[model samples]
Target: MAQAPDHAPDHSGEALVIQKVQPFGEGQIVLTTPSLDADGRLEDRHSAYHENRSPPLVWTPVEHVAAYAIVVEDPDAPREHPFVHWLIWNIPGEATSLPEGLPNEASLGLIGGATQGVNGAGKIGWFGPRPPPGHGLHRYHFQIFALAERLTFGPNVPLETLVSALKGDTLAEGLLVATYEAPESQ
Candidate 1:
């Protein structure tokens, strides 16, 4: 009674080619900040970075994808199971797009060469948007899975063992959702 990790990856869907991006969830790469505050202006909350800063990814060029896995969860964090802030697999299928400070503790170009896993505040790479002040707005989701094979699960492997070894070897999947609010300090 606990199975949501098929991870898709059997091939033969016409060789493969799926594109499902909800504009802001599929591909838009929005970072905001051109001037609209007052909830109408550019709305500045200290925009030096972060806004979807790492939630606009997509992929579909396969030919033996050896590795590529990303899982950023938030599920309206209040603590439970949907809190894994981030977790990267191998990533490197000719790459697509993951620009926005990404796993940036310094540099995470986004590709199979990428590395990181452990967010939820445990800190490893990217932990922005701290919502808790009033706990009103909180919806941070960024998922990009694509793997035919290529993972070792070393170095951390939190997020429930990287979603349980990515189940079936997920072939392709992309998602992005951003929203944060935690201002009520003194």
Candidate 2:
């Protein structure tokens, strides 16, 4: 029952990812997934209104990384900034693939006691895409941060806090962008 910092985090994923999220020099991990369709569209099974499950994800291993963090965001939401679908952290450095349908809870034992952060929905773990119906297509940016050291932070850490902790510890970062379009209204 730990609380995050006293302030709120910037909800703009673009701002966070591009400007604020700084990893070591020109470093990028090749993030990939087999869950998306040929057109790089996410499956309905991962939709918030549907199965609401997490898609399987895999990334190329980075050298000398002690941990990894991932943040899934939709910069196309009707709101002013990006909408966070998943806020997860504390992945073991040896993990190269995340199994599909990870339970929505803090502290995952399957991944060596990895912890989860809060999503835009104010919940722990992954909250699959639920863009408004007929809102065109939304781009989900699944960003990953490779940390040089294992971090230990207070509970309920916001995305900002995690990003802050990654400042100098980030060895590299990468992304796998996926698209989703809600079905039009009946």
Candidate 1 lDDT: 0.52
Q: Model 1 misses residue 57 by how many Å?
A: 17
lDDT of each: 0.52, 0.82
Best of the candidates, lDDT: 2
Ten consecutive residues with minimal summed lDDT in candidate 2?
Answer: 7-16
Over 4 Å off, model 2: 1-14
Q: lDDT tens digits, residues 78-183, model 1?
A: 5534565667667676665555446454224545367776676676765555655666666555566667777776536655555556655665565555565665
* TM-score, one value per model: 0.28, 0.88
Q: Score residue 4 of candidate 1 by CA lDDT.
A: 65
Task: Write candidate 2's Cα lDDT for 53-157 as tens digits.
Answer: 999999999888888888888888766568888877779999988999999888899987788878889888899998777667888999889988877864387
Please count the clashing residue pairs in each candidate, in the order shown: 14, 0
